[model samples]
Target: MDSKYCPDCGHPSSIKRIDRKYIIHEIEHVLHFERGILYTIRELILNPGENIRKYLSENRSRLVKPIIFIIVTSLIYTILTHLFHIEDGYVKYHEVNDGTVSTVSKIVKWIQEHYGYANIMMGIFIALWLQLFFRKFNYNFYEVLIMLCFVMGMGMLIFSVFVILQAIMHFNVMSFAGAFGIFYCVWAIGQFYFKSKVSSYIKGFFAYILGMVTFWIFPVIIGIVIDVVSK
Candidate 1:
């Protein structure tokens, strides 16, 4: 696998490998604090409202609380991304001149420079739509929105961790795949916990739609807010 090093932090690559045993170990540790982490991940993946129901039902100690999880995960994920400078795709660079440039070439160049904003917009909408569909599984609209706040927050945490990894360790693996894999692991544990109660298709589809959408939504919202407030 391709790897990198962070010049600033000098934290070398410590990841040994990705494997079933390792994953199980991680889940086991999480189970100690919250058994519901497995089911939360599962409902987050398969049946959106189910997790919320369990969470609200006083099975409180069974999993990592969503709020805390979101805060920690977002920080780690963003830091990793920042450190490694991972790119979903390349951004076009354009030169800027003082004030205004009134030419076709200049306009195109400006657009290229600013094009990342557009990609972010599309990503947010798609993620919201996926969450919306998943919410239809059992949740009403408000609940779905609430769940999305936490879910998307987790995605931000994941990305923030990526930024940290990039800055501190010069680590940048494919992040979306990493997100999907982690999401899958969470779902698997939930399935095991729930046994025959939840449908596989529900789990699979939920992850597919929400995973990609969450990836885009959080950052875009933050970016928009910053832009609006700054103006």
Candidate 2:
């Protein structure tokens, strides 16, 4: 009779069947209350570039998956914003039309309401500029995207902390949080490329701002095209 374990390997005889249960079990076991996200957070805080580099090159068992990390962190920020009524307009805009919802307006409102997914979109936008600025580096566009996933998630976490602080202290701190988030992102991007360089860090700063501007410009361009097509 054939054994369950591999005859030569002494592991599962065949590949273990992967189903929804397998996925759930992995998430539950790895991302348990004691570790997982918390450990990821700590590592990212300490050395985001080094940790992310390890994630790509070395074992991935340590940190949470980038996609999952961003989703979870964005959810935390979104929940806190709603819970504390923090209407700082992180991704929102005031009415621009005469009670008519334009394409850009709708998109902005959707992003405001769904930060978890919106952050992913925003990350892609940021990744474009990052790849452009850091083209000399070995990292490709998708690699850059993965890096932004972790970086932006950290930014959301930063925002989440400030939102909680604003709620408790009754002092507006979202702006400060925004500054810190941007600073961290720039530093992480710079570190990812240059071990130590003033120019790389400076470029990192511009890359982030340009990435944000580029993302914002997309909705406006779409809105214009829609209006032109309808007219």
Candidate 3:
């Protein structure tokens, strides 16, 4: 304990203090996850920005890795949706199909059927848009990706809860999750990037809306390009 060297790294204690702390914290978090995954989920819900910043800048051992978290959440949501037969407005419209469903409804159904792919495609589009719009924040694509994974994973979890509730209560609140997703992203981005609450909310709102718009358009543009190329 009195030696001037880090016990873990064998470096000079003064210079390696931060590194030593990081290593200790990382080990503790790994042990914590072995105790329960709920601890990480609770921290993510209550203190997302701080936790995300920690994972991005410090040791990532404390939190579930972003990609794995996203995949797990997505799979849970997919299961809940199928199990509960929770049909969103779009899904309901798609089922009618008595020459009443619009082309958009069909497309929405297609997207829903391919939910995993759509989720990831939309996530990448949203992350790219965030990076472009918030370039001043100096977040690289990878960092933005981590942020999106957390936000989207949380959103999918919320949606899964809503789906379960709908199955039990026989009432539709599916759209509530989508609305919550928009607000959640806005609040999360604001908290993560901006110091001023008012400015952050303003920018975050615009960014979320524009991000969704871009996400929606990406598939349309790709489809058009494919059509043109094939023709």
Candidate that would win on TM-score: 2
RMSD of 3: 9.6
Per-candidate count of clashing residue pairs (backbone under 3 Å): 37, 0, 0
Please give the CA lDDT of all the candidate structures. 0.47, 0.83, 0.71
- 1 or 3, which is superior by lDDT? 3
Instruction: Give the number of the best model, judged by lDDT.
Output: 2
- The TM-score of predicted model 3 comes to 0.72
Off by over 4 Å in 1: 1-52, 60-65, 84-138, 149-172, 175-231
Give the C-alpha miss distance for residue 24 in model 2, angstroms: 9.1
User: Against the hidden reference, what TM-scores do the models get?
Assistant: 0.38, 0.84, 0.72
- Cα lDDT for residue 59, candidate 3: 67
Please rank every candidate by TM-score, starting with the best: 2, 3, 1
Report the poorest 10 consecutive residues by lDDT, candidate 3.
87-96
Residue pairs with backbone atoms closer than 3 Å in model 3 (clashes): none
- Give the per-residue lDDT digits (tens) of candidate 3, residues 1-231: 498987888987676456887887776564455544576688778877888888889868777777767767777888888777665622233244566544455465677766556666677777776776778887898788788787777777877777887888887787687787677777777777763567766776776677667877665576556656766
> Where is model 3 more than 4 Å wrong at Cα?
1-36, 89-110, 224-231
